[model samples]
Target: MTGDGWNAAVRRRLGLGRLLALGGPEDGVWITERAATSVLGAVAAALPGLAVTSLRLAPADPGAAAEPAVPPPPSALPPGPLRVSAEVVALGGRPLPELVAALREALFTAARERLGLVVSDVDVQVTALLDDLPDPPNGGPPPGPTDQPASATATAALTTPGVARLTAELGPPVQTAEGHVRVEVATAPPHHPLEVARAVRTAVGRAAPDADSVAVLITWAG
Candidate 1:
């Protein structure tokens, strides 16, 4: 089908399937269904005020010798003049005045037109500049009396789970510039991997209430 055909199919008034059967670019715009969804999603995001009322695509004939690039139909979309905003703030210590302002503006501009919120202002602070650094090659503190010195090979082996072991075998799946807790556990026979991952994330959230995002990765053995 031609570009006009695509427009017509997607914009059809009666049935909605026309929008789903989106055809390739007949007018050098787009043709594939995935491409159509992306285009539609972008338009929707840009215009939050407008509500998408309808969507559909055209149909294809399998018996035809050659298929034409036909768009399903023109789906009804909301007309828009949407507005959205966002801001970033750092509490407590004072951030560099200019940097704080820049961060706020950057966040606001980035989230505008996507999320429908109005941000009046943002506050930022730089509480501390830590002087602590990782230990030098041989200048670190002596091993604690209670600590056991495991062989290098043994340490490496602990990093990878054995056939009977499941759940995380390494450090925390998510690490931040801020502090975080690492957890390692074994699950029973009836546990699901997805459930374990979700649980880990929830636990981390409880442990680090001030973090920005939580991440969880699961590895299994056997």
Candidate 2:
């Protein structure tokens, strides 16, 4: 199917809601199904050696209508809790159950804290186990500058103390600009945001000193 057609089908199957207005109508706070999905996707993508193949959100009541019945009144409220499900491909040798459990926790925490939405359930399906390839013989003749993958940048960020995990939305973790390196991360809580940012900068610097500069973003503190 075409992209738009596929999205329409997903909307029909999942019964997604439109942008939800929160608090007084004049307050102007709002959240969209797309936003919620983005948050959840980020959480899942952050897991080391795991790749999210698909993510779906379903209404708490499966039979609910696909579209809202009427325009919300002035005092708009959030929608009911949702059910989240995902398909993933994992690399490395970590136990599947352990990874799923961690993904569930991260999803729950992120949904609650970021969107104030309650996720009633998180179902993770491991569709594939990727083999870990052995390193090139003799260290692969050292990578040339700019040959580094974003995953390497993410690994450098993960090395920082107290960093729980990088957000999956940060695809490839490293962005290069004008000879500088930029790294973005979302960390689990218990550590201050500023401290985590500092740690990430230091770690990235050590890992890639050739980088003209290292920029770090703490997308999540808790």
Candidate 3:
């Protein structure tokens, strides 16, 4: 199987066992893989000129079986150090190496500070480069005052404290139609999903007041 396929199989097998088990004798606490990925991916996607396509987690042991035995109890688990891999398409013009290094650092910090996951390494693959140029002068129509780059919208949403990350499957978070903007996001725990959505709406509204309507979709809030 390909690397991605193998990784997916391994993750499925790990399931909730991937949750980071907290230390101490108090009732066990766990942070789910979904939450960790959301935070890490969001941090990476928030960087200027970078857009994450997908994020994956791999076991430290390459030869580990795709299916493993049942996981141990929370107290028995060790502090895990996992590998994080991301597929991204970045905009041109900026120094690629510097941008990648920034992304790696951001992911590492987010994973460590937010989820207590010791990220052994972050592997970012630049799948494509986005054209940074504006649309050629067309006889059709001039750009409107309300027109804003999707990246800006994304940045605004990420400003919210609890927002873990934006879903990459939906392309850019900002979608414009008839001069209105729609922002989609995924938030981490401790904050209510609706509260996060409201925060995003407020941020986007401030950034793009010209928008006729600002819509926020809380795709995943855990």
Query: Which model scores highest in lDDT?
Result: 3
lDDT of 2 by residue, 62-131 (tens): 4532322223322223344567787877776878888888888988887666555546788889888888
Error of 2 at 174 (Å): 37
Better of 1 and 3 by TM-score: 3
Give the per-residue lDDT of model 1 (tens digit) for 1-222.
899977665553232121121111221111122223223333433421122222222232223212222211123111122122222223233344654455545434432322221223333333333333222122122112222124332222223322123222222322344443322233232343234434554555565566544433222201
Q: What TM-score does each of the candidates earn?
A: 0.21, 0.43, 0.45
Ranking by lDDT: 3, 2, 1
Ten-residue segment with the worst summed lDDT in candidate 2?
136-145
Tens digits of lDDT, candidate 3, 146-195 = 22345667778777777776653223556666766766566677675545
Clash count for candidate 2 is 1
lDDT of each: 0.30, 0.55, 0.58
lDDT, candidate 3, equals: 0.58
TM-score ranking from best candidate downward: 3, 2, 1
**Clash totals for all candidate models:** 29, 1, 0
